[model samples]
Target: MSNKCKTAISVIGIVLSIALLAISAVLAEEAIIRPALAVTFTVISAILVFVAIFYAAKIDYETGVYECRKCGHTFKPTFKAYTLGAHTLSTRHLKCSGCGEKSWCKRKNRRV
Candidate 1:
């Protein structure tokens, strides 16, 4: 999925979680004893949040590859390449192991 889709889902999950909590509060204010419904919503919201997190951390460890533009070398990136580089998707600041210089890198689709 695209970054925009991931962002949208994340926002929706957060909004749904907030709305469910607010509804629970309203039910409590009215002295309603529907514990089951409140718990159900809470659980669903938690699952949604997990899904959003999964989408946000979109690293494919199996077949993910990055190619260095400077040395024409292809290699699998380390987790730090995604976590500590310029950004999760862009690895321009990462040093090429073969070239020993910082260069732009392109992410390749995960091979099946």
Candidate 2:
């Protein structure tokens, strides 16, 4: 499997383990668990959700290969993780890879 798949599986396992621990703790001792612990868990869960979003938004660096539209030079366009979204890279300005030219390579990236 790829490194990405391995990392994803590890993250899923951690989340599942945390869930199981929470369930076991609640079932074992009703008095030991406090409201603060509940709030902490909530905060941790929210943070994890945001982290997941960031990870998903991160560019697949190994997969962003695109050709120059003008010169037809096949090259890998730099994969940038834009806060705006995937379409943010559709801007007019583009750097070419073949001749080191600063021209508009309007080609869209195909997922490989």
Candidate 3:
């Protein structure tokens, strides 16, 4: 699966879990069997949300790609490559595959 799809699924899981939790709260106010069912559903949804978030983070860490600002080169540098210089969320110092210059590079969105 692609990073974009994984991210989308993770977002959906978060939203769904929030909605389910809200509904569970409402159900808990009433006295009936529905309250028990609501709690079960809420627990399941919360677990799903957690799993989705973990999967998305793993994908991001593994497939992070960057683009050079000085040159139009796109490359995936290793973790050591990033630590070799300096990096930030917005910019990074890495050798450009196209220009071979160690310069500040811009972070590119891995998702489509």
lDDT of each: 0.63, 0.53, 0.72
- Which prediction has the highest TM-score against the true structure? 3
Model 1 TM-score on a 0 to 1 scale: 0.48
- Specify the poorest-scoring 10-residue window by lDDT in model 2: 80-89
Q: Write the per-residue lDDT of candidate 2 for residues 1-112, one digit (tens) a residue.
A: 5546744755675576567556645744665557677566656665665565455444333434445556777666555422322333553345667877665545344443
How do all models score by TM-score? 0.48, 0.40, 0.48
Clashing pairs in 2: none
- Model 2 residue 50 lDDT score: 59
Ordering by TM-score: 3, 1, 2
| Model 1: residues with Cα > 4 Å off, grouped in runs | 1-51, 54-58, 61-63, 88-92
lDDT of 1 by residue, 1-112 (tens): 5545545666676677667667776775676857787677667767766665554454343335677888888776666665467745545456777777776777675554
> lDDT by residue for model 3 over 82-103, one digit each (tens)?
5565766667788888888877
Comparing 2 with 3 on lDDT, the higher-scoring candidate is 3
- What's the ranking of the predictions by lDDT, best on top? 3, 1, 2
Misplaced by over 4 Å in model 3 are 65-112
Q: After superposition, how far is residue 57 of candidate 3 from its true place, in Å?
A: 1.6
